[model samples]
Structure formats: C-alpha cells, structure tokens
Target: MAKGKHNPERKAVRHGTEKGSVTLGGRRVAVEKIRVRSVDGVEIPLETYQALQDPELLTRAALERMIHGLSTRNYAYGLEPVGDDVESFGTSNSTVSRRFIAVRQLKST
Candidate 1:
C-alpha cells in the first residue's frame, strides 16, 4: 500500500454524502461512511475504510479475505487437491476450507 504524505496543519471535515456500495468480483457490497483528513486538511469521506477498529467488522473482513484468497488461489491452481492444500495460500491457518471449496465449485460451474 502506498502511504499518503500527511500535512499536520490541515484539519478534515467529513459528511456522509451518499450511501456506499461497491462491486467486488461481481458481488455488490455495501460500505459504511468514513471520514478522514487528507493532505490538504480537507475532509474526504471514504466509502470503504478500516474494518479493524471495529472488532465485528474486522472479523468479517478477515474471514472474507481468507475466503477470497483461498478461492483465488484454488482457481489459480485449477482446484486439484483439497483440504490442507488450501492453507498454503492464506494469511492464517484458521481459514474455512469448506467455504473456499464452495467458492471454487461456484466459480467452476
């Protein structure tokens, strides 16, 4: 990730302008409003921000990333061996292999 240079003198002001939504891998995902200070001290609202600051959101994001990563790798490898093979591509060992399998099956069909 590229870090934006920060300017301390600028303060940000944020407002929830519109409901946030995005299309990831053909799936429509709704996002929450986020307010952050830009380099110029102007407030820019982010439709998708940190899921970490909120425990529940973070958990959901972690699970999603795991599933996405697994499914992506599985497809990349042509979904050969199952089970423990899936673990080699994720950020953690606790990923749900079955969920990734389901995603793989969905993609193949």
Candidate 2:
C-alpha cells in the first residue's frame, strides 16, 4: 500500500469551540467627537486625552514663573532683606536664602 501523506488532523481530537464577544472593563460606551474652532476660522476636532503624562512639565512651568518673579524683585529692590518680616511677606527668610543660593548655583552651572 502507498504511504499516505503526513496529516496531523487524523491524530487530533475535536474540542468545543467558544463563541462570544470579549468585553473589556465593562460594556463599551460610545463616545461623541467634539469639534473646535480656531481664531483663524479653522475647524479642529478635539479628542479627550489624559492630562500631563509628565508631571515635571507642570513643575518646570511653575518654577519658571517663580524664577521670573524672583529675578524681577531682585532687580527692582536689590534683594529684600531676609528678616523676621519675610514670612509675613509671603515667604520665609530661609527659603528665600535657599532659593537665592540655588539660583546662583544653577547660573554657575
């Protein structure tokens, strides 16, 4: 007899097939798209996205503003005297001194 071609199907057992849609988290919710407009009359589509993946971006923004304010004050008033009244002025004397040193170090770097 001629040998039959290799067929793994003859040695296999049939298993029950599964039929169902896989739901993730919960039932899928339909989201509506939003349209946006620019000053130049351009129509843009806005998508809902997660806020600030990098927290450092926010810190850098605030730090930039703080540095700008400090620089302006230093130039205008020649660095206010660090004394007991510093806290009443919205910042502590030690904190101000630390910030001054940190800025000087940053500039030197």
**Of the candidates shown, which would achieve the greatest TM-score relative to the real structure?**
1
- Candidate 1, residues 8-107: lDDT per residue as tens digits? 5646645445445443222224545455665567666444444322334333434465555644333324333334422223322333344445556777
Summarize candidate 2's per-residue lDDT along 1-109 as a digit string, tens digits: 3486654444332233422221111111122323445545565432322222233333343345456674423332433334432222313344445555665688799
Record all residue pairs in model 1 with backbone atoms less than 3 Å apart, i.e. clashing.
none
> Model 2: clashing residue pairs?
none
> Which parts of model 2 have CA positions greater than 4 angstroms off?
1-90
Model 1 lDDT-worst window of ten: 85-94
Query: Which regions of candidate 1 fall more than 4 Å away from where they truly are?
Result: 1-8, 16-18, 35-109
Predictions in order: lDDT = 0.43, 0.37
**TM-score of every candidate relative to the true structure:** 0.23, 0.21
